[model samples]
Target: MTSAIPNRIRAYLGWCPMTGAAQHPAPDQPAGAKTGDLADSGGSVTGRADRFMHLTIAVVVLSYVVAILILPFLPEVIPVHWNLQGKADGFAASIPGAFGLPVIITLVTLLFILLPKFDSRYAGFALAKDIYAIILFATTGMLLVMEVIFLLIAAGYDLPVITIIPVLIGFLFIILGSLMPYIHRNTTMGIRLPWTMKSDDIWKKTHEHGGPLFMAGGILTVIGSLVSGIWAMALMLVIIIGVTIYISVWSYRYAKTAG
Candidate 1:
């Protein structure tokens, strides 16, 4: 019996390790390895320095928007908040009101439009433009939420049952739109499960399927947002996370089998 057991273990160990997944163009390289369009273009900046600049700009714009949205609700020049965790936070509460969300959005949107023109390779993908629109819409909804919260605090307004509908719709559009660029590309964004990143085909297929799934889920999220209240947001989050995981695993297995 011991000899038989040893033979069985040996057989198992000898099984093929590759598992039949389709062999990628190069396993060691990241997905979208070619980005060759970027290398030859004078208009594009591929250095880490350029990337940092872009990220810094994005953060600044986001901060400016937050300030614009929060200032109008402040009773004084200073925005103050006391948290249950024993922290006091204070800022210029009137900043958001002074800027007005619409004005902030417009300025940010202009930046998005102009930033893409700076790069030749990225000019084609135009992610900045899309992100700009998504951020604007999202900011609008967030401003509305802020208004609701303020009303609840100062006016005892429960936030009309119907006013929330538009906010929900706006939120869905924002979420779905935010995923678009990532849905279109395969590098360092939007649900980077290890297996999916390991195989290029898996990344492509998963995103191809996941893009639509997430969009649909986002639409449902809008519906849920207006109908079921906060719980709806929870459900939408679950669906997005769950579908992303499922597709990642499926794509990995499928690639392995096809290869």
Candidate 2:
């Protein structure tokens, strides 16, 4: 039974392995071609998404390598948390703690790649394959930055870890904002709400209008995170909250009429 697990997983993934990339056959291929065949086929969406999966795997592998190299140099008790002023406010003595983030990010990468396969509207993934690839790249790339920051702090770099995290998060939001308009309807991710999920047209419209607002908010977040004093992160939090509410209301209003 154990031996069949991988096969089952591969079967479940439908040979695309990257966010439902090959669920349907490519046009140029013979109608009789298998799903896995598209992964190797040039100029196809499946081929592009599969390449993204490969890069994501490489990032995860590099994270592990970084953790291994830095573990030896980290202090016995390193700061795990930082204060508003970027001072170390918490500590832990686990040397193996370094590997924790690598493991987490590995799982996160998998989640980004695999979760879309099971999306209630699973077919949506194929239409938004590029969207998935870009989002995955942004997500793993941000986590990689966080991973590096953690290690550097553990090695006593006296870095502004707290201040930097929000900026990174802001950039991630910016990336998501840019991609929102391109996203097809999917329940597993995006600005999913009861209203937006009702229709594909509603989803597209909401994203088209909301995408710019989100980008504006992300810009504010990045700016707010950079400003010193008066709790920069708090300002970012407020901006994020305000932007979300605005976007939600817009989507809801549009969806109400759309329905």
Candidate 3:
């Protein structure tokens, strides 16, 4: 999944995040619906759940309000970056530092908003629309929490960001793992490995295998962060890298053995 296609065409007709620029709708689409919209025939909960997605803008505004409140108290230069040991190393001028997260969050929210429209499996993306909304809102909430904490730090509150961040992230992964099994493969999100690209059965099995592993890793990350903040962050990175490699290999092997 990558920047392999011109975004304009990708948004209109849609293209998988990886593989190639060209794509076509599923051949078996229902007479009056797209491939995944078969569920919409049964009175989908997606519409009710979609309110969470709309709530993201409200969360974004809260971050901006927080930044405005905290700006007057922040020093002329604030620590915008931190080292593994939680030491503030990177610095930025006050105004930019104060509003940093709002700008970043606004851009990220917009990008997420556009990603689904660009997804080649546009219909499949809606298969688990409830999960997607929760995932999106939860992720945005996590970032909002970070923005609040960072602003507090900039306002001279003493906090261990290195430790706090890992715990929060670990929980997020757990939530993702629990919900991941329900998501169908989509080019713009989730696992898009070559083997997963092969078939729906492979994609389904891969996520089923991966869900528990993701939760396990999250548990380890929480434990690691609590026991040793700095080393835990290092271990967290290693776990992420290691898990991705392991999952890719696992999908490949499973794909090979499947009939």
Candidate 4:
């Protein structure tokens, strides 16, 4: 039984037990083609994807470099935290405030890049490579944007944080919503709930519903920001929480009925 487990795992992973070779279609082969008849099928797609990934990494790294360069120019105290009203309420030493946030963002970008390799459900990641790439780019891009905004604020730029932040957030939600439907079931990403993880159909349906909801909420958030920043933040939070709960319950119900 102990030895049987390894074989089972290998089989599940589409690996040859004897040769320890991948049993899946080669990257050069059509999805349903015989493994032996390989061609350079996915090379162009892979190359474009790699270029995008590299571009995202470079942008994130450049953001960090900008932060480091501006560190000396920033005041000893900098606004490190904001209130619901989008007012800078918390202050910290410039060294930590300016440098720490960029460091954390760098670490987060690294984590996002490495997570797929460590995920047991990496096959799902491969299937949803486009979705994964969008997620990576969106998240890293948001961080870079935020870093630049903070740096500008530190440099005495009176940018309208209250309006800009909400607009940025709204755009982010729109991007995420647009891409959410393409994401596949994966343990390391997406709206992972017990039911959604267990049922592919549930995952698909929930994200389908979720995408539109998020888009609507994001639009409302942007409008609210113009009217009332504090209210916009509150409403955005409500929308997110409400959608999450609704999806979780919906997944559960769908799973139960299907079962």
Best by lDDT: 3
Clash totals for all models, in order?
11, 0, 0, 0
Better of 2 and 4 by TM-score: 2
Tens digits of per-residue lDDT, candidate 3, 1-259, equal 3565555443432222122111222323322344333333222335424456667788889989989888899999998888877888999998999888888888888888788888877666765555666677778888889988888888889988988888888888887777666667777667888778668888888888887788888888888889885776787777777777887799889999995
In model 3, the Cα lDDT at residue 151 comes to: 81
Q: What global local distance difference test value does model 1 have?
A: 0.45
Ordered by TM-score, highest first, the candidates read 3, 2, 4, 1
What's the best-to-worst order under lDDT? 3, 2, 4, 1
Which candidate number has the best TM-score?
A: 3
Tens-digit lDDT track of model 1 for 106-167: 56545654654554334223322223333444444454444434333322234433325334
- 111-200 in candidate 4: lDDT tens per residue? 877888877665555655545655677777877788788888987988777677777788788777766665667777777888877767
User: Which pairs of residues collide in model 2?
Assistant: none
Evaluate all candidate structures by whole-model CA lDDT and list the values in order: 0.45, 0.71, 0.72, 0.67
Winner of 1 and 4 under lDDT: 4
State residue 151's C-alpha deviation in candidate 1, in Å: 8.7
Quick one: how many clashes does candidate 2 have?
0
TM-score of 2: 0.79
Name the TM-score of candidate 3: 0.82
Please provide the root mean square deviation of candidate 1 (C-alpha atoms, Å): 18.9
lDDT of 2 by residue, 141-238 (tens): 78888989988978878666656888888888887777777666776777888877777777778877887788888888788777755476677788
Candidate 3 clashes: the total is: 0
